[model samples]
Target: NGQSTNSNEKKLAFQNIPRLPREVTPFASFTNVIELDQRGPLFQGPGAKRDTGRYKVRPTDDDSMKRAKKFSMEQSVKYVLVRQQQHQQRAQLDLIKKQQALLLMCR
Candidate 1:
């Protein structure tokens, strides 16, 4: 009776083994090669038109405008600094001239 029970348990274990579908055999073949006519942009879908011009225009113009504005702001700031330095130098020269005039009168 014990031998019979052991045989039944072995049959149940064999039935529990996993199986793949018969249509997908392990010996099936696959290829990685694509035909030349089928090659196009990877992200684009089948039968979709490519728009090359629209993507090229907007970002370049925006970058140039930003660069121009930055250049103008830098030029204006430099001009203001030069003007301040010139004014300060002129004030110092005027002070020196007034001191010289006072010394001449004292003599």
Candidate 2:
């Protein structure tokens, strides 16, 4: 009895299934319109490729470039100062070593 009842319930459920293609017609038309809009025009004259909008132009302001150049200059100056300090320390060490050697010889 239970098996027969389950089969009848499944048969009733199958009767209510909706047709998909008919319901999706509006969506298909919308997608078709979008595809038509995306396709660019054919028959281009000579040198027309340069005028196309494929490559979007960026802003003309050079603020970022100027900032990058300033940062590079600041880094270079820091490196130069650090190297100069290292050289000065090395020179001082050499002078101290020479004085120590002279004192040892006097002894």
Candidate 3:
């Protein structure tokens, strides 16, 4: 009787196992994240036959070329402004030092 009851229990357990939900659909793909698309030409080299090289042109290069003369003048103006500021700051500090020395000598 005990052996028969154990067999029935085993059968009951086996029946419960398949009732649980199974994977209806397959897992999502990982190819998109794993394989990123390149931004440039596939192949490029001096010895190679093809000239497909991934070379991204910098925005700064394009900007400089588009406004080469304007940028030069603007850069000159900026340099002069910075130089003037530095000279003014140095002159003020020198003036302050001279005033302090003069006061000390007078005292």
- On lDDT, the leading prediction is 1
- Candidate number with the higher TM-score (2 or 3): 2
Score each candidate by Cα lDDT. 0.89, 0.83, 0.85
Q: Model 2 TM-score?
A: 0.44
TM-score, per-candidate, Cα-based: 0.46, 0.44, 0.38
Error of 1 at 71 (Å): 0.5
Best first by TM-score, ranked: 1, 2, 3
Q: 50, model 2: CA deviation in Å?
A: 15
lDDT of 1 by residue, 3-93 (tens): 9999999999999999877658776576578767757666757779876675555888999989999999999999999999999999999
Write candidate 3's Cα lDDT for 1-107 as tens digits: 99999999999998888543344435634445577879987776678777589778699987877798788889999999999999999999999999999999999
| Candidate 3 clash pair list | none
Model 3 TM-score is 0.38
Off by over 4 Å in 2: 1-61
Stretches of candidate 1 off by over 4 Å are: 1-57
**Considering summed lDDT, which 10 consecutive residues are worst modelled in model 2?**
29-38
- Identify the runs in model 3 with alpha carbons over 4 angstroms from their true place: 1-66
**Candidate 3 minimal-lDDT segment of 10 residues:** 20-29
